[model samples]
Target: MKRREFFKKGTTAAVAAGVIPLVTASCVGAKDMVYDRKQDKWFDLGTGKTGSNSRKKTVAYDVAVIGGGAAGICAAVAAARNGSKTVLIQDRPVLGGNASSEMRVHLNGVNNIKGKAERETGIIEEILLHNRFENEQESFPVWDHVLYDFVVREPNLTLMLNTQAIEAVMDGDKIKSALCWQATTEILFTINAPVYIDCSGDGLLAATSGAEYRTGREGKAEFNEKFAPDEPDGWQMGATLLMSSKDMGKPMKYSPPSYAIKYTHEGGHKRRKFAGFHEGIWWIEVGSDDDIIADFEENRHKLMGYLHGVWDYIKNSGKFPEAENLALDWVGSLPGRRESRRFIGDYIVSEKDMTEHKHFDDAVAFGGWSLDEHNPGGIENISEPPSYFHYHFEEVYQFPFRSLYSKNVSNLMFAGRNVSQTHIALSSSRIMGTCALMGQAVGTAAAICNKKNVLPREVGQKYIKNLQEQMLRDDAFIPKRPANDPNDLARKASLIFGSTTSSGDAKKLINGFSRDIDGKNNHWQSDGLSADLQLEWESSISLSYVELKCDTNLQRNIMMRKDSRNDELYFNGIPNELLKSLSLEARVNGKWIKLGVIEENRTRLIKFKFDTIKTTAVRIKMTETYGAENVKLFEVRCYA
Candidate 1:
């Protein structure tokens, strides 16, 4: 049968049965093999072409996430974990977007804010922690596989790699299905989902779905943004091709390709910098003058030429004798794009929001990166600095839920660089860490939308608090936002500490503030490693889940940096304060019963879910720490 007919049959059966239909790998040819037209009609499910290739496959899920970057990964993972069936599609063979081996741009997040490290928590941190455990060599190729491993482990998530989303089928303002093309498999994927998240970085799905969007810088008067241009313009930050070099034992000779552009110090324009050979060179940029999306192929060529020219200058020009022993190890074939189409939302984040550090009631994410806007001139103009660091905040600023979902497209949401933000505000929030948080927020929101059968805007309006509380329960931190879940039984119980007390009160455990937010004191500390914390109520409370928030030392960098030393490797390892072993027990009819026990716990936030039981009192026994001599925790909650 034709693939399209098969898909139609499968989808019809699945809808009647009220279940999702998956295209199993066993039913298809091996993923690595390219299908031949005549020999394999079943394998070559062509992309709507005549004669040989005129078939497509259809699938269904609760949420569909387009793009497999950090943001998309987090969104899909979050959505799946929150009880929604999710699908993630990436055009590339591997994930990680700029951080992948294909692009080689270092993954960056909320590393530091005002001299204090505030590493982003939740799914992004979990991925980084997993990388430290699995990818000890810190190899870029290995990192790609690590992400794949983390993603596939979620049984509720379906990942489609090497698949490009070409069309978005819409019903009114809702995205009914996203049609994708997988060249290798020659399969057309028609993914139907209730909620769709556009993490494609370029906002392709949102644009195709007719989501309202903007392309370039907004005028200062638009949002009272000081960093915006005096007048609205089409100019945007350029794309870049990152390259890396390694030091050989001896001198190395270089020969440029016939098409390589020759370079000299004069070509440097005095603005392009060549330093820190171990770190990837990120200034080989171009393509802001033309259409960033429409002229993608033309821009990539210019970026590639500029990359080769910069390398040629470093190797041939005698300006730097220190680089004689260094050899080019890698050059990215794909450009790490910076800016493109940004979908419109209920609230547009402006430069003023970032500079003034405006805290939003609906905040779901935060960013601390400085406002570093690259010059529009790119590699062609050398007179000015590569970018302008126009503004810095006193601390990290929060991103509201209003900027995540499409204003017109009811079921559509977006993350990464495509979220609803003015060009000037995007300069800071565009970092991967901030994007990851946005992804988590939107993913969780999508799950909620699926559960309630509502639109994205409805989620922000009615269930915004519920969504934020869910994120907190999952260990995601929202700046200035406190968790006040009414369902938590511990919030009403009496709290007691069994060890040395910190300056803060033990009541902070039930205060709803998990992380350190807005200089608020909402954490409890013990003087020694082994401590017992308990919550007691007058009457029996039936609970099935217990969540504990332990301190994970956010003051140190946990991510891998390109120029890190051997001694600094420990920073990527387990945090010293994390509780390695713990046990939870409840008093049933005046006798203690073990509810859950954990060993080798590596995460800052740990939750124990078991069969529901009635208990008058519950206590947490922490016997070991990752390395620290004391046990410090932020919050503990029991859910009914």
Candidate 2:
């Protein structure tokens, strides 16, 4: 009756009977096992194959990612980087499902601190940096290639493009394998893994494998979410087919397709064009509120017609003087869907969690974008406005790890827009940046689970805490602050340097360093530091070590003097002669502190220290001899 023995016997029996086995009594215990006589298998199965009749293939992986979007990519990279044998199965020919180059939708996420640079970390960050370097500006196709290159180059990652995961194989409550179809070869291959992640934005794997999920919005009372509708509504946000056009100098004749005119103005105004309008910003019209997968064909035809009509209108009308030279540039091959099946995980993140800024015990990621929900119906229904709710918190709110794994299905974890969150909550966290962070968390968690041989739900907060710390070290920001207090101070100092309310003393010091000098700080004045100035001085002095000193601890104040011409330097501390024989470097606390030298002026501070004067003088002489020309000395006052 031991679990291992039972699993062995059960698997053997199922294989002999040609039946697909679901859960093994050994894994879940007899009381938890429910046999399905009709299917000739155990209930609560994750793998698609049933009874002995199903095809079987041998494959093994440390971690398996079921989608190739932002989440899947991050998850796979994190696992691989962490030394896990990771495999990524993507249904599409190219990566970047919604934000792909073929789809041509810009990745949208609010930069940290409003004006700070975008958060780029892990594999996704590398790709973004490469793209920036290659294009100098944003180019969708180039960005896509960079993403592709990142995955392909990773040594521990196995990327199976154009492969669809049709079924998940489960041993008791854990996923053992997934059956995927290779589009090119039409061969079904099995991928076995100790851990699996569901990044398919549609929750395809969770649904097919019997993972518990929800398809529509929840009632307001369930989670006490203020944004939820009074009653459960089946309606979900619509999808859009993005379009683009180029200037052609003269309008070209075009014919409208039959379904292009589906919308007639209720007030008797002429119908508006829907496609071939402008560049990147133009989005064509199509069906909404209807079944997206089922009606996709009809919608495509209507969109084509709309494009033709738009071109016709441009040729015949004189409204667009600037667009007279426009021509059809490109159109999206697939529509970008915003909402789909939301899997029910161990925890459901609600709007209240976001609005109230609720902090979770197992926080993994943070999101700051506003709650922006597009209506279930497409653009035609302009009678009602789109839902827009902003979080009151100036900082990003933390998301818990529980929301990433399914409550009913023990093994599966999900990320991206399909994470276990209500529609309103998803509106804010669904952005690519947040999703990338979630992906990193999931990948790291999966690796931990695989190494520890524990379920993701059972991994506990300590593991998640470790993962968050690692993420911060890797440059991905989470809700929590970093451990290094000095880093915090340095960041604060950087911000203060550029602020308008900077003190007169601070401004004088900044200016004296020469507003735009190179390392020497001797070139043109007021030009500001050149772009090549090394903010990160790997081979130079450590800026953090530099500090100001005063003779008296109680009255420790230094005045920075500025001349009428706005060019001067002054330092106050112990007089220079007192410490004349001490060899002291201009380094503050072992960090380099540079003072721009004025050749003809007496603009240097005196120094004094309690230690032997010889050692201090030696340090100073060494610094003055080898330091860059811009380096200067200031009075070092001994405080008692």
Candidate 3:
């Protein structure tokens, strides 16, 4: 049978009947597909001075992650690092969807919760810290390069820019291939994988694959969401055009463009006050209830007009003299979008799940951002507040694994704003940081799915613990869940102690809680610098790696903000509590032998991997920190 015919009839029937007695061209056989510049020859065409060659390329990966935003990057990195050959496809030249240099939106996670930040850990934390180390100047354009560096350095991942996954080749309910169009190269790409992750906020691939999805706001009756609209409407949260102004050190004149609408703010809501107009104004936005995606260009023009109008009001109006020296420095032509299609999953996260702190047995991630529901008609409706700021969370809540995968499509998964959630739930969970946690969870789960040769649902159903444990081992903090991997030698050690302790017990390191919470200490704090923490096993065990989750002060966020706001809640620079110098030694043949050393550590999770050796005891000597007088660590893990 022809490839297309087999895929359409045979593969579809086999998949629907829950049988796999078809030709090798099915999903399982797709791994044999390969795409390298060496193999496919592009024939020379005499159509133009430069040969215009167009061909289709089919590349196979274990995981195909669509989008290159914070969530997509984290998902791709997590999947790649967890032993999956992954490919990350981005429509834009740069990564970081909303937080990119193009949008200049702040890469915010759980910035503030009850006066302290419950910062996201794992891959996302690593990314934020990477930026802190590399982009000290806090330049947005440089940050673009930083994100690019983060993705390209991953050996197991392939990044395709200027590529859009417009269509999906379906085998029954599963996505067999994604046909992506690369505008720059003018090449069509068919990316086949066992698992397809739609981290793109709009979820084009999932939508094309016939994955069930919902758009716009959900009514209160749908999920008993207190913060949801009283009656369901087609209104999706708007997108905002951002602009930054600079102080010219002299009085600057301003003029409104022809497209600029006249802004009076005459009947504006009291909550629409512009406190930080020097930076971008978040209220200069627009939304559409019906087909918001189709209204993107239309709203974008209005956003630009509204942005300048608001600026004109701020500069010309006699409201205040604060804008005398401020001149418009940077204006974003592309508006940062917030809401889009939310794909259906086994479990739809509702407002109560977050507000009531509902715990899920399959919990693999956490989120704590407030229910910040943007008003129906942003800026256009001046009577209402820009954001309702519905509800604030006191503590982080668990996000279920069931909500990360598609309900109808067997192998499709999603993260970011497009995940399975109610409109009210998205209000809080839509934060990039929270979405990143979900990304890591699904990415790790995708690797698991590939290893077991199973679909996403089976992994969540039977091997959820395995997925959760793997994520925990990688330093992902799951709320209300502690890392208890049986393979961790640190937990099995006969004795674990510290050289000095200012507060908290040394045994807390083995307790599995990687962060201090609920007024309970889960860390080992040295009274002063140059401390020794050792773990001894009753019997010698073969070890090759020692991982430690050092102190980075999770309470203060380290994400790059346009204002570079430094306060009690946020740290503009690197955390002073991070371990700067550390060395690991193994007690081999009764004598201590130095195994590895880290002179300058940038990651919160430090690793010491070497050849396997039989050692009864392991000693970690931390000599210095960035600035803190003492050194602290939450957990220590050893693996073979």
lDDT (Cα, tens digit) per residue for candidate 3, span 109-190: 8888778888989999999899999999999999999999999999999999999887678899899999887878767788
In TM-score terms, candidate 2 sits at 0.65
- Report the candidate with higher lDDT, 1 versus 2: 1
Q: List all candidate RMSDs to the true structure.
A: 7.8, 15.6, 6.6
Name the runs in model 3 displaced over 4 angstroms.
1-52
The residue ranges of model 1 lying beyond 4 angstroms of the native Cα positions read: 1-54, 267-272, 565-570
Q: Assess candidate 3 and give its TM-score to the true structure.
A: 0.92
The residue-by-residue lDDT of candidate 1 on 476-499, one tens digit each, is 888767788889888889556655
lDDT of 2 by residue, 1-640 (tens): 3322322353333222221223333444544323223445644367765663333345788999988888889999988877799999899888887778667655555443332222324445544444544543455666667678889899999999998776666677666778776667545577888788999787656655667655557778888878778986655666667666665667554445565544332332123233234643233444344234445677666656555555555555565566666666677767776776677787889887876778887887777677876655444553444344444335467788899988877888989888888978887888776787889888988888878788788775446666665454344545444323223212222211211211122222322221111112211111111101111212222221222211111111111111111111111332221111113233344455333321221112232234321111112221221112223221111111
In the predicted model 1, the residue pairs found to clash are none
Q: What is the lDDT of residue 399 in candidate 3?
A: 94
Q: Name the lDDT of candidate 3.
A: 0.88
lDDT of 3 at 138: 96
lDDT for residue 509 in candidate 2, whole number 0-100: 31
